[model samples]
Target: MSIAPARIDEQTIRALPKAEVHVHLEGTFSLIDLLTLAKENGVALPGPAATLFDISTHTDFETPEVTTGGGTGTGSAGLSGFLRFLDWQCGLVRTPEQAARVAYAFAARQSASGVRYSDVIVNPTHWNAWRGRDLALMDALSAGFDEAEQDGLCRVGIAYSLLRGQTAADAEDAVARLADASLRRVVALSVDGDEKTTGRTGEKFQNAFAIAASAGLHRTVHAGESSGPEGVWDAIDLLQAERIDHGVRAIEDDALIARLIADGVSLGVCPRSNITLGIYDGWASHPLPRLLAAGVRVTLNTDDPAPMGTSLEADWAVAADQFGFSHDDMVGFARRSLEASFADDDLKRDLLTELEAVVTASTAAEVTA
Candidate 1:
């Protein structure tokens, strides 16, 4: 008789303390939620909401320049096409009430998935409701986060993301507004979008990031996903990014890999999202294992959980099945995420302690079994 391996269960994955640092708020809404929003706001519902969220339908999302010949460009479809979808999804929210609902729900979902902490990124420009009113949007979003924290769901902080195509002047203005807002729940500043389509480099926004850093704000940048190793270099050398979201392409350059390891920078790797976005063919081809072996601090995340049809639990399972990460390795990934977060030291310590206890208990149970 053949022996079968035990299957990973929710109980097993949920028992581990997880932290997410690269999720996007716009991409979190479900088809049902979008439909509800449309009905409530009197906005015409888009047809086949299911197709909108399906990555298979948008195979052209990743442009040929980056996906083939290892060329360097935004890895996704041209700006007009991808942005059309992104903007359509983002346009669903026309009021603070909708924003708050999404934020609170996201926290609850993450809590149930064993994510103890997260730093959710949202690009304010995408929302017409937040046009020329960044503070209002921040306040509304923060209120939602506050409720979630009080309810003991999960601790979440907002990372205000700058769109990639924004001018230097626009970047400075946004950062200044962020500093002035000084929202308690807002923890970091980030830049996200298609780097290849925008033709913008990290150097373009160095001064804006500098201003944010001077304000004691944490920084992360989207790099090496759609672009190449040089994009990662610019993020580290020019923008002084503390973390690189979807930096799988960093494996292309030995010097960049060494630098990331030496500097203790974290790479928030999203496995499913990379494949869905055409950055990689599959998890096996992803740079995560290489990055890990090269001593880079790697943390698994769900970049666009809903759109990519992934959750923290799902990502963790994939990492274990594909990467062959042991239980201890999963725990290490969680621990590093908490450490890399913008969360306070006390929270980090508490979460770390809880994770240690989980490991101990799991080990004891295994021994007994």
Candidate 2:
């Protein structure tokens, strides 16, 4: 006979101390902050400030494009609409002050959602061109990181991204900048941008990855997000990445799955982003559960909170409601993320112990209740 389904309460889910292993820092800018920064920077947006964050209208997932005359541009329709929203984001945050504000707001939001630590991916390429000040962008980013950390809301880490379409020299420069920033303990070096723009395999990014690795920075790549499992392999073999972002397609390759598990490489999984982008039909069909069952270490995150209409808590809720992940399973995911994180040994151990206590205590309390 079939067994009864497990019961998951929202309180238990929310009470689980969690950590975000992948998130785009700029992508986390709340609608209110975005509009405020836009107004201050004199950038013209399509609608009133209030409408920018309106979940109902904005949630109608459409493809993103550069709009003129208040009309959406034609493009690959999907969660990319949210990515298009980010294209317009540069104009709004053109100063160091704005960047710090974005960081603060993002940390506050994550803390409220039960996140104890977060690794925020920041694309300096966008900010460098937008600010055009020749100032130390990495220094400015460190300032933001410091402010977020000082808030005591969460332990914050930064990942610098190299754009895929950039020239080899440009990629080298991005890596050099990241290497210099690594002196201050930025977490990892990431490669992002349009996969098609760089031919998916990203031959030019190798030198950048090499430089980052030489500087003792961990490496991750936005692989298998737009391409297939082969893209994930290229990132592993070609770039020597220590982790992968949106590696859902890895399930398609038995050899790759075995290699990933054997090597202990982690996959930063974003469930809602997958659903919004049509990578998976829904949470239940998402490969995350399968990946986890197969012994692949996976961590959940909100790729773009505003555009994707999700938060850390909401993503966890989906894992419960759709994937049937128990509260224990969700806590296990968080603990694994801390262990697999790019954080230093001391911090990782400390956070792991804290999370274990939280999980153990919460589980006992649930049993008593």
Candidate 3:
């Protein structure tokens, strides 16, 4: 008789070892943080801070009109409205100290979900205050996360994002700026923003990605989220992304799916966000299961946890419940997350060791029973 691995239940999710690779700093602010920052910054509010992101209860994202004026996130549905909210929310952090607070909060929040490390993407275009002082902004964030490290919580790596519509010159400038030694926490160069609205921009930033590759920085591109399979192809071909964010749409093309597996490019998938933003009708229709079935290297993430109202562990549970993910599947996804992250080799090894301990303990317990 063959012995099975320890069974994974919902509670096991909290004990699972994982890392988050696609979370955005702008959209991860907690409601309490938003309230505190609004009070400290004297930002004008449309209503009470408690109900700021509670404006919508629906899940369809058919609207093309961008949210305008003082509307509290959810004025319109889909990616455009979410981008506008990110702009408004990020603007609340007018000082370096506030940015530090946001970074610290990231460690604390991910810790609760048992995430060992997170590679956070922060698009500079969303901020107005630190428009010219890029290094200073990162310095502040690094300081905050460093403080959290003392507590032994989740470690963080910063990835600066280039908005899709930005010119190639802007991409060049971003890569050049990121190369500075003072920006200590930056590990990867990323491209974010809505691909549908910005259209095809892989060619525009191709040179910048090439520069980043030479400079020893990792490349992550946001593709197949708002756009289709063609966008994903550009990421793999032109930009040569090490990982693709929100790549659910890659399922639309069979060749694209094969390419992702052949090229060993991981996709950071956010199932809850996809449904909440109406990217799909519901969880059943999500291509995540299909992608996994096709042997794609996919990892679950909370793209914007606070804004989308989901957590890393919660996403795992949902996947387990909806997709019939077994003990091995969840464990394998956790392993994939660690392998796919930009974390240093030492940290990755240490975390992987801890993961094995969790598994071994569970196995021993089962044997004793």
Candidate 4:
């Protein structure tokens, strides 16, 4: 029997109100935005940033070693290409002002994409060292958050991220900075970086998690993306994350799946990021459907709009097309996202009501026409 294709209109899907739970602040930079920022900041582009945005450019798989340590190392060639791309990105974002500019532009672009609310991950450790001023880095990022919220384009929140390579002292310092109630925009603390750099050992950043939890901040950790389902367990057992980012691999273990369902933990599911990183061969083979069907609370997001060439709408389409999700399923995903969001109860209820109206109107239009 032939499989049915997912029926979703790109334009209509773009109009859907959605909450993005796993987007990275720096990762949202579009190729056009990156180029403009580079020129405005007097930074040089390695090549044309625009070319990376071209969907037609087939990655050269033969020359695997041309690039260094980036991309989806699923194949030798893809890994090399990713590394080269990372080098290009690193070259462009060198100062605090550049980071702020990227943040402002990213919010504008995401606003245009119809995202009503978003919680973006920000890692200041690497950028701080890059700019050689810890206080300056925080101030610049805080400014970006203030500007985005004031514009009323979207309700923005920050997840102050801890790098995997940081020492215990580094984590302590990060927590201390976040403990300051003056930074009211920061809603949570997260761990993000090379997963291998910080495993389940819990020695490096355990104190950081404790600090965040004590400060009444939400906790999220990146696991099971590069590692397997065990990484998911480690995050919960060690870091005590209320949510797991890219926890798709949790499907590998039955007990783990049961725990996730019973505990009501949220998974920040990024379908395009998985396919681009070779976690799943393609969207058709991704485990999002299985997880959702199994009663796991899954929310959609764009890990990086520019790097992975995806948006929140594109992610919903992938779910519909690849997983055979119905219109109700799409609405359910949106509701799940809002429920899992860090937004206050009042805002959450309001967004859910608005989303219900959107679903109703779309369904009514389809039925009438």
Candidate 5:
């Protein structure tokens, strides 16, 4: 009789070294944190703190447009709902101290989840309360990350998020914000938001991205999520994004898949995020397996951990269980994450070494058993 393989569990998944490159800092806040911040800032709540904190209801992201100020149109319907919730959370932090606290908490939480290093995406424009104080806000957020590093929780880097659907002039102003010396912690410039609502692509912000490239900032743009493979191509050809967020849709086009493989571009794939937003019906239907088999560099991430109800480890466990990944395959996923990160060489080297040793020890023990 043939023997069945052993199962992978959460414990094993959590023990592996991992990194999250596509997560948004604004979405990391816990419900309790949101309540506290709202109370501290005197921001009025839309409903009972307890009721709004219930993310169980918020899981249905396919609902109609719920907010007025953000954007409009068809494709924007899905992600715009999440963005409105994000705007509410961002609006709660009215002070520099609050921003610092939120940042510190985010690092600590991810560290506890087994993330050794993270590139957190922060879009200043989302924080309505911090208008005209972006420099101070960046400095405060950096201070929080610095304190977390000093305590050996997790090393964190910032990726300034550029909102989509803005005018060329607005894009120029967005790039100018990163020129501040106090925002030295920023290592990359990223674009996100509803591609469908904006009815635009990477070409719209090429000049702004060119400025970021001139300033030595790495690029990662969201594409092929709500739109299609054309968005991914525009990001690669026009913005020259080093990494593409949610590029799983590239599987739809064979030529695009060839280009992604040839160029070694990494895709930050969030399986749960896709399912939750109605992009894919469920985990088994996700294109992760095809993307991997096609030789494209892919890494699992929680686009918004707290709100999306996922973590790096949870994503790994799901991948292992759903896709039949072995222990070695899981390790490869972790390794791919570090390789795809925008972290400095020194930090990446250290994290990769630590990851390799952990995987070796664990696999050896499994063999001995």
Candidate 6:
């Protein structure tokens, strides 16, 4: 039997098959993984080990003080600051084995959150240790993910990313190497970083994205977050982006919102990340529900779950608890993520079938209860 979308139970939302298309592998570091990797690599902690990754410094969710941003371009406050943190923590990897372990752990975490498939972003710029060995890096990550897939963990594809701070030459060089690498795990060519710090970059990297497209890699861009709606326009028009990461700022331009609806481009949105980074005031002010109501394809995600202390389910809870979204609205968001993923059609179909059955059972349980 089919399930109705009226019930807003926690069990059904937790059980629904999910797809995370915007998560960063650099940001998936759990406290245990951090310690294990630190010990293995002899990386010193910048502060007290126990509270090094605390959310208090990163967010003002419960406090009365209005903490807008985190750090500077070189520090840890705004989008620029957060990108630097990603670079710092991601540098702990000293070998292919370490890279594999990170990828394995990423898939396992996603599986724990009911994510059946994921497209994880890994910017080579962040991994200083893996410098000159990106091909081997992708291979290592793919090997780990392959092992996880064998064990029924979340099936993963890598969205190889270039930091926005890189030059046009850097973009060209990265794409050329990826085109020649023949890595099966590399699914898309993505560009992410602090756009506000870099200014307009679409015109500069247009050729690079074209090369990636020619090489059969999908295109995704991080825009409409650090910058304004103009950045998103550049992503779609110049970069030919198939999907956008953190395109929440599109709400600023009604024309852009209509364009997104017309072009059918899905956005991978991280609501909590926005709040932590000082983009939005709080959950109530987030643009997620409005974006959905406007007929825009919005996919729920945890942008940097570990550092932000959030999960896919936690983001969905924002829609339910904060916005009073019905179960149907929440399910629609989950389904959009699955549909937006770069995963194979067969896998997506299987995941959708699983989702249907779980939702049906959960709905029935809720009805009887």
Which number leads on TM-score? 5
For 140-236, candidate 5 gives per-residue lDDT tens digits of 8999899998998878889887778566778778777676452668899888877766655576799999988888899998888878898899999
Predictions in order: lDDT: 0.79, 0.71, 0.80, 0.71, 0.80, 0.81
Worst 10 residues of 2 by lDDT: 66-75
Top candidate, metric lDDT: 6
For model 4, the run of ten residues with the poorest summed lDDT = 62-71
Instruction: Please give each candidate's TM-score.
Output: 0.91, 0.88, 0.91, 0.86, 0.92, 0.90
User: Candidate 1: which pairs clash?
Assistant: 61-76, 61-77, 62-76, 63-76, 74-196
Q: Candidate 1 residues 96-167, lDDT tens each?
A: 888888889889989989989999998876675567887788888888888998999899988988877678
Per-residue lDDT tens digits of candidate 2, residues 260-280?
998888998887877765666
What residue runs in model 4 are displaced by over 4 Å at the alpha carbon?
1-6, 49-97, 126-135, 201-203, 364-369
Tell me the tens digit of each residue's lDDT in model 3 across 4-41: 54445557887988899988888788888877887897
RMSD of candidates 1 onward, in order:
4.4, 4.4, 4.5, 4.5, 3.4, 5.7
| Inter-residue clash pairs, candidate 3 | none
User: Regarding lDDT, does 1 or 4 come out ahead?
Assistant: 1
TM-score, prediction 2: 0.88
Backbone clashes, candidate 3:
0
Candidate 6 structure quality by residue, lDDT tens digits, 192-307: 76676678889999999999999999999988987889999999999999999999999999999999999999999888888887788898888988998899999988888987
State the lDDT of candidate 4 residue by residue for 191-214, as single tens digits: 776454344545567788988889
TM-score of candidate 6 relative to the true fold: 0.90
Top-down lDDT ranking = 6, 3, 5, 1, 4, 2
